[model samples]
Target: MKQNIHPQNHEVIFYDVNSGYKFLTHSTKTSSETMEWEDGKLYPVIKVEVSSDTHPFYTGRQKFNEKGGRVEQFKKRYNM
Candidate 1:
């Protein structure tokens, strides 16, 4: 509702470093790096450490540590 109060949004590429995945989306962020997209146009590329491509929760690769509760640990320690 204000004039020139919001940041500019433009097409940018988000690159997942872990999974080597790249996707184009709109964001207010800018980068010095640039990459050519599938549509044959160059866009500002932003590198991200985590994304849906390799995230543990999204990919269903999460690990659960079942070390047991306090009582179970006590029993195991005392051999009871």
Candidate 2:
């Protein structure tokens, strides 16, 4: 660990575009866009397409391909 060798880590806001969720955390990433947080402090804002709030796997919305009819074929093959 040397001085001035690492980038600055600052608190930034990550906005989820799909879920409309915003959270503040420390990141080295810099953004030109800034937003006023709940604490009345201005911080860099980064927009993300997906987040845990709206991700399919996290929300348990991942669906098997029903159009393939694979489950039906397997059940029929096994007489189940």
Candidate 3:
């Protein structure tokens, strides 16, 4: 093990905006906003747009469009 060679792993909060989910983890990322946890210590808070908590795949809310409808309409108009 090398001394002072690895980046600091500090406490951080990953906030999912869509689901309003919060998770505490350690990472080397930096954030300008700070949050005081239950332990009364200030940690960096990072807001993310998407995470497993709100992702369509994990939540079983994924949306998809049917291409057959559009293709039929286009073929009828263009005679293709």
Candidate No. with top lDDT? 1
Cα lDDT tens digits for candidate 2, 1-80: 67899889989999987667999999999699999999999999999877777678888894333333779878878899
Model 3 steric clash total: 0
- Model 2: runs farther than 4 Å from truth? 62-80
Considering every candidate listed, which one attains the maximal TM-score? 1
Flag the better candidate by lDDT, 2 or 3: 2
Better of 2 and 3 by TM-score: 2
Using all chains and alpha carbons, the TM-scores for the candidates as numbered come to 0.74, 0.69, 0.63
How are the candidates ranked when ordered by TM-score, highest leading? Answer: 1, 2, 3
Residue pairs in candidate 1 whose N, alpha carbon or C atoms collide under 3 angstroms: none
For 22-67, candidate 1 gives per-residue lDDT tens digits of 9999999989999999999999999997888877888899433354
lDDT of 3: 0.80
Clashing pairs in 3: none
Which has the better lDDT: candidate 1, or candidate 3? Answer: 1
